[model samples]
Target: MSARLVLHGVCVGLLFAALAGAPTPAKAQKIYIETDLEGASGVYKFSQTREKDTPPNIEACEFLMGDIAAVVRGLRAGGAKEIIVSDGHGSQAFLPRLMEPGAKYVTGKPRPSSGLDETCDAIVMVGCHAMMGTPDGVLCHTQSSKSENRYWYNGVETGEIGQSAIVASYYGVPPILVTGDEATCRETKKFFGEHCVTVAVKRGLAREAAELYPFEETRKALFEGAKRAMAELPNCKPYQVKLPIQAKKEWYELDAKGVKGKLMTREGEILDLRDLYKF
Candidate 1:
């Protein structure tokens, strides 16, 4: 072979070898979803009714199910390989057949330490509501409707979103996206910071009257928010609750005199319930 031709052949071979040795880009990580029915689009009441005697302006459970489906579809399109959704709401049973095929759903009351966590790369909250006593928040109650409970970490009143973020942080996972009423989304941003993507489905007025969007628009918003959240996953920081966790409960109706246990600490006239209640 001619020297020039030989030199060109050697250079071409080296280039091909180098190209072959390059590493492939990694695939996008899967997402975890935690869904609640109350903050879903069009929801404005505590009852999940869609039959006779139901309120004329009541929101249907089917509508919320569709919104959740839309979010799942969008997340899938955004390169999520797997999804696990926890039904984090009253009774934890709303729509079972509506979820996408192959998606896992966790229903029923979640234990104190059992929710979303380390198994997921990113977490998304759907149809969540604001904490108790949030101004203009729809059915704004934390945990339950009957209880006037306040969850605090280091004396700071943390909302539902804050509590959920703390749980996610326990496993080193970050809460990347949250969708709900305007008040809930606003509170989520305040607690989780600006990096978290938030989608507001409705505006509340006195917890009952609110400007709400149709199901179609809400689905679109949820889809967009999910995509944005996944895209910005790298920028999300895990929410950390500084250690030495302490829980204090003041019973309004429980009989304190009948309570029997080893007392841990007593402050003035109030007793910390943790010392008496086991579990």
Candidate 2:
């Protein structure tokens, strides 16, 4: 073979190898989602969450999905290439089969905090209700609506949003956006700072009823809130509620369904109901 031909062939192979090894543009950012159903717009009735074997109201599920989809849409617009959506409501309120496309859906109990960490960009919450016994909120309750009368975290009363945010803090991830009733949004803003995007889907009127915003308006708000949260990701910081987080739950009467149900844990040590959180 001629020297020039041999040299040219070697250079071409080197160029091809280098091009093949080059990393692709647009690195995918990870977004963690925690969603419930109580505060979703269009879900003002108690029967939605307290359904029997089968979900009696398909419309309720659609409302939940619509909110999830809106936030996911905004996240995508904000450059989120990956997302993990967890069902935060008790039982299987949010179905995995009906999750947003290209997203991971997790259901069942006892979520592991190990999976969420500093590596993740940020966290989002949708359709979360207010603290248990919170007056004027639709389907307001802590972990178990029927069992838990109230839950205290290091003395402060908190619902699912606060509990989950505290757990996510363990891995150094902060909650950016939280959507729920007006009261829950106020609560989230108080805990996570005013910078956090809080979207209120409904106005709490009672335990089982609420004045809901127009569906289209709410969808727009959710999407915008999510995008804003992601855009201001740098401003969001993990909310460390200080350990050992002394938590206590007031039990309900035996007649209440799901009274004996257990609360979810994430590196949490359950102390005596009366010892840590004393009246």
Query: Which candidate has the top score in TM-score?
Result: 2
Error of 2 at 38 (Å): 0.7
The C-alpha stretches of model 2 lying farther than 4 A from their native spots are: 1-28, 52-55, 95-98, 108-115, 256-279
Q: Model 2, 1-279: lDDT tens per residue? A: 999999999999999999999864543389998888888888887787778344555668778988998999998897788898877666556655567786777777665532566677788999888887778777888766766567777778777787778777767788989999998988888889987899998999888878889999999999999888887777888877756666655665554554475544322444432122232
Q: Each candidate's TM vs. the true structure?
A: 0.76, 0.78
lDDT (tens digit, per residue) of candidate 1 on 34-152: 87777888878655522322543224556667777878887777777888877776555446767667467777654674445566788888888898888799878766545445555
lDDT of each: 0.71, 0.78
Model 2 pairs in collision: none
Pairs clashing within candidate 1? none
Question: Candidate 1, 90: how far from true, in Å?
Answer: 2.5
For model 2, what is the error of residue 205's alpha carbon versus the real structure, in angstroms, after optimal superposition?
1.0
